[model samples]
Target: MIHKILNNKCPHCDKGHIYREKNIYFNFRKPKMNKSCSHCGYAFEKEPGFFFGAMYVSYALGIAEAVAVFIIGTFFFENTFDLRILPWIAITILLLSSFNMRMARIIWIYLLKGV
Candidate 1:
């Protein structure tokens, strides 16, 4: 599960490529997703609105990331209430938004693949 979520591969089989591009970083402008899995041939997108669930996944990931940053910053910086933390979090989210979007969709596909 962790591997599937983090690497964005088919949950049942890791050999398949969830996406067609070499990597997600440079492929943001054009996400070339395979219509079906290369290994298992599992359909990546079943129907319209299938990926809507990815929104929830994205929100969950964003919240988790924000909370993690808040906790780590509070622990190491020892700053109870620092306004800079807000900017830092915002920047982090902005930079990671692409990856978050892809991961969210991948997770959603994995969860609802059988359905």
Candidate 2:
């Protein structure tokens, strides 16, 4: 499942891709997702607004990434409370926004697969 998520493969039938592009980073364009699995015909969005939950996941991922950046920056600079890392954190988040969105959606899909 983790492999599938990372590769953007359909959870239902790992053969089919969930996203149109194999790599989404540095493209400066929104990632395009397939409506259903090409191999298994499984729907990506189970219902209307199903992906809304992915927003929460994305937010959590952003927070985690930001915290990690802050911790790493502090350790590198030997300053625990320096505000200089704020811009770096923001930049990291901005750069990873697209990745977080795709990851969040993939994670959300696998998370609810059991239910």
Candidate 3:
């Protein structure tokens, strides 16, 4: 589960990518999904509202990133409140956002099935 989420693949199978382009920042603004999984042929979006739960996954990923930053700065850097650290936080969030979006959607797919 963790590997699938982190790898940004379909939760059921890691052999396929959740996206076609390496950069989702470009694709998400317009929104496009592959016709079928390259490896497994699993459909990524099954229905119109299939990705609503992905919001939760994105939220979780955000919180995790924030917490990780907070902890690392607090313990390792010894400067928890420095404004200079803001760029690090922002960059980390931005860098992870694209991957997080895909992971979130994948997580949603798996969760609905498990329930």
Candidate 4:
């Protein structure tokens, strides 16, 4: 499940890649997705501006991740509202931005397109 989603495989066929670039770490570029699945020819965009809704999903995912950082940071530092942990949270969020972007799109597809 983790492998499939993170790799950005086609949700419908699970065969073709969703993004043109697969090397998330080495490549500094954003995800460039195929317009349709290579294997089954599934339309990735679905409709015009379909992925625009994914922004909302991304925002939700970010909030959830931020909350997790707050909880973990508070527990680790033994401070409920420590200013020191703020930088840590910011760094964590920045480091995971790309992953979050891809994951958020995957989540949006899964939610609207079904698992």
Candidate 5:
């Protein structure tokens, strides 16, 4: 299941892909998902707003990444309460926004449907 989520495979059938072929990590454009599994014909969206919950997951991931950046900055600079780390945290979040979105959606899907 973890492998399936990481690889963006369909929850029902791990052989199918959840997203279309694209550079979701670095591309500025929104990543595209296949409407259904090419191998098993399983629909990606369970309902009209099924993926809406993915936003919360994305938010959580952003916060986690920000905290990680802050911790790393503090460790590197030996400053526990410095404001200089704020910009680095923001930049890291921005740089990883696309990946976070894609990962969040994949995780959400697996959580809801995978065994």
Candidate 6:
């Protein structure tokens, strides 16, 4: 499960790339996508606005990440009321935004594929 999410492979074949580019860092501007899987020829676009559902998944992921940060800060930093953790958490989420978006789409595809 983790391997599939980490690699962002096509759920059908588990081989082809989903995004047009392998590097996630570069896609913010173009949001490039392949028409179909290179390996199995699976269509990435299920329907128009199919990825709209991915937004909700991404939102859930962001919330989960924030909650995790809060828990870890409370336990490890030993300070729930510490003001320093706010910016730290924000920075962490900022840095992880791209990775989280990528993973959220991957997870969303997996969820739809299983159904």
Best-performing candidate as measured by lDDT: 2
Mark the 10 consecutive residues where model 1 has the least summed lDDT.
22-31
**Which candidate achieves the best TM-score against the true structure?**
2
Whole-model lDDT per candidate: 0.79, 0.87, 0.71, 0.78, 0.85, 0.78
Write down the TM-score for model 2.
0.93
Once fitted onto the true fold, the runs of candidate 2 whose alpha carbons sit more than 4 angstroms away are none
Cα lDDT for residue 42, candidate 3: 78
Candidate 2 lDDT, tens digit per residue, 1-114? Answer: 677688888888789888898685555588888999999998988899999999999999999999999888977786688989999999999999988998999999998876
Error of 1 at 36 (Å): 0.9
Predicted candidate 3 versus true structure: per-residue lDDT over 82-112, tens digit per residue: 6666778788888778767866776777777
Write the residue-wise lDDT of candidate 1 on 22-78 in tens digits.
Answer: 677434475677888889888888887888889999899899888888877786675
Instruction: Give the C-alpha lDDT of model 1.
Output: 0.79
Model 2, residue pairs in steric clash: none
TM for every model, in the order presented, reads 0.86, 0.93, 0.68, 0.84, 0.91, 0.83
lDDT of 4 at 73: 84
**What lDDT score is found at residue 67 in candidate 3?**
74
Residues 15-108 of candidate 5: C-alpha lDDT, one tens digit per residue: 8898896565676677888988999998888888888999999999999999999888888786687898999999999999989999888888
Clashes of 6: 0
Model 3, runs deviating above 4 Å: 7-15, 22-32, 38-41, 76-84
Clashing pairs in 1: none
lDDT of 6 at 85: 75
The TM-score-based order of candidates, best leading, equals 2, 5, 1, 4, 6, 3
Write model 4 residue lDDT over 15-52, tens digit each, in one string.
Answer: 98877886753444678878888999987788898888
Clashes of each: 0, 0, 0, 0, 0, 0
